[model samples]
Target: MKSFSILLAATAASVLPVSAAVAAPAKNIVLVHGAYADGSGWRGVYDILVKDGYHVSIVSQPLTSLTDDIAATQRVLDKQTGPVVLVGHSYGGQIITDAGADPKVKALVYVAALQPDVGESVIGLAKTMELPNGDVEESADGFLSLASDKFVADFAADVPKDLAEFMKASQMPVAAIAFSEKTKVASWRSKPSYGIVATKDLALNANLERWMYKRAGAKITEIDASHVVFISQPRAVADVIEEAARAVK
Candidate 1:
């Protein structure tokens, strides 16, 4: 509670309207982090959305289990006083898919995340498709990690070297088994969906990203960046989230 921060300052470029129509409230935004990253990485997108007069909250996931991450994100959603645009990055796709089932969630935005449907899992999807994290190293205790040496090239290829290095140093370690847990529901199935597909992404297969989006019937936008497109390309990411906000009805 005390650890969570609410970003209210405006900084990033504002979003354009989709159309003039009666829609749900787009005042709240909740961002969920994926594995090998944390909420701090959402600073850029947070600034953009907050500046546009949206109340933005970044969920600090425990990265220990799927249930824990979803619970943490839901807790953040619970604090919002109005409809929320739930956005997730990387493994956070799974988190939002689970947490976004809440009635307060108006829509969903996936940024280079693993969008697993009901009865599917993170590892299950990756196992069927080719992922870009070939250099990721798992520990003996079941926590999965990315090598700091290869983290920059594999996860944040377009990001500056210094920032990528800092991300590697502070990245969260996710429980390897979390990837194997099946999703009970995919909120995108019942909610409006938007996606940011990273063309240069190496951690996730671009085709798989598109496949998931297409299946979910998401409003898709492609960006030429790496896995951490939220950092390398915050504008596009924020724009899609805003679009999701606008799509609410």
Candidate 2:
């Protein structure tokens, strides 16, 4: 962790201590990534959370359909030893919305992610926002991906150019139809949620990020970063996730 963000987290922790009733925060954390990205992107945030004595797990959700992604997350959830703090980024939000209803899930954290209601979909929710041009590229075989050239600019401008370029080349392919798949459940309705809004995000509207978080009634945090704020601002992101975890301990 960077010195500044460590201090930033400490300051935030001081201002908001854990409640007396929470004997211990949920020890298990499950991280879910969005489209065009994979579980590896969560390494930085994972390290911070682990260092804080939290047992963390990552779900490699295949970007096929909402049901497939939810199934993938459930596999991980089923193995947890205790209640889980379910975290999602971008498109992964809907996955948690569905899987988070699992009895093992205790909390949710959204990192500039989509939060839809029962029967809502990524495409339906996207229609409410002004999406970036060239941010999405559809392959002939039907998989959707991020445009390599625009990735750094739209997805990870806060990240270094070299790392951003590498991420572009290694991008995960999401099924284009995933966006149209509606969620059958919205866990945010039944569970407490924490949200992070990337102020400089271009791929998803910053205003829409605010709107969705507000709609979910989440405790919100804002950062001046692109969509991949988790990579560029891992410490701060981890802090917020930790905050949500601590509340449900």
Candidate 3:
């Protein structure tokens, strides 16, 4: 009778749903926001991923120091048990490029984001190409911001007027010193990557976005949107991330 009971218990455990067996190690999606923004920028993307049954988290970068931001991201990466898909937008791209080196990160997705090479600072990368709208401003505090006037036309052109206005009003100040700091490591060099190019992006310039994508050897996806592609096209962003998550080894 005892042998029969043990065999029955083993059979039942083997028949459990994959997701229930050992919890199946949920795949993690870490959303990293760019300059003049916080993790809140990923709210829409986060909501969608949640509905789709994904384990997601957003990294609220201080925008104060590159090392601090990378460390913050790494801290989150360290907590994840399974594979991670690191997604970054705009300057957030720089953060992921360095932080994604964590062994837990299986793939990278750059959404209208910068992908700097080794020894390249944000300024150095920007200088290499001509941007459509020159709207970046350097403040006396040694930080960078977008000129309020250009916020609508350059940063959030595709978004509704009201939301664009809100984004302009709530823009975070990014430390200028952060732009000069070089990424000691760039994960895209070795990891598989996907790049989304905002065709109408005025902040970074569409051409420059494409150039970065090609330079990084990323599988490219183009969207008719502004620099904040994730905000204007959350579904598309989520779809690409979903694809990357499933493809992770």
Candidate 4:
């Protein structure tokens, strides 16, 4: 009688509905940083996500060209063992918009980042609306960077002064042509997307961010911070990313 009971339990388990076995939530996160900043700026977001049991990786893209940055992002995506919630900040959004098309990417999160549609370039979009701060500097060799004197005011008004200075000192200069290079694809169309708009941003127009996120149909979160929203409001930024991660499955 005991043997027969065991056999009946095994049969019932085999016939259980497939819905009982839900797929695991994505645990990997890949972060991409925009021009003028390195992956280190994602440190705050990284620490928060890690503490919550996520496997996070940050891509340090060379600001030489959009194509090169996309390739750098892809290399990091390739190393992720499972599905990823890809996140990008500032110009890094442009990189992820292209690289997020990778099959490994399950969701996208843009933090005060640019999201250009096909046939659009960063320069083209930025030109659509005037930037609040006019302290951008272009080198004779065709590289672009924020003026050190205005970096804090224009890019990180909410960030502590000393850290902002350090960020300015270590800023990465981008190839001027990168802003003019047109986007080849808009990955958000195929993936679930979330966006954080830094309402007080001076580097990139806040209204432009709204327009782009609206066009992409991303779930948008507005934070009252400077251009470096992730740095200033890491908890809020991480919450949006976690929401995307949980909903992707």
The estimated TM-scores of all candidates read 0.89, 0.90, 0.89, 0.93
lDDT of 3 by residue, 44-115 (tens): 899999999999988887898888889888888888887889999998899999998988898999999999
For candidate 4, list the clashing residue pairs, or say none.
34-92
What is model 2's C-alpha RMSD? Answer: 10.3
Regions of candidate 3 where Cα sits further than 4 Å from its true position: 1-26
Under the 3 Å rule for N, CA and C atoms, how many clashes does model 3 have? 1
Best by lDDT: 4
Candidate achieving the largest TM-score: 4
Candidate 4 lDDT over 96-138, as tens digits, reads 8999899989999999989888888999999998888888899
Tell me how many residue pairs clash in candidate 4: 1
Give the TM-score comparing model 2 with the true structure, all chains together.
0.90
Superposition error at 126 for model 3 (Å) = 0.5
The order by descending lDDT is 4, 2, 3, 1
Query: Over the full model, what C-alpha lDDT does candidate 3 score relative to the true structure?
Result: 0.87
- lDDT of predicted model 1: 0.86
lDDT of each: 0.86, 0.90, 0.87, 0.91
The C-alpha stretches of model 4 lying farther than 4 A from their native spots are 1-22
Clashes of each: 3, 2, 1, 1
Cα lDDT tens digits for candidate 1, 1-249: 333322222211222233322344588899998999888999999999889889999999899899988999988988998788999998999989988899999899999987889999988898888876677788999998988788888888898988988998987889988898899988898898988899998888999999999999998899988999999888888888887887677
Weakest 10 consecutive residues, lDDT, candidate 4?
15-24
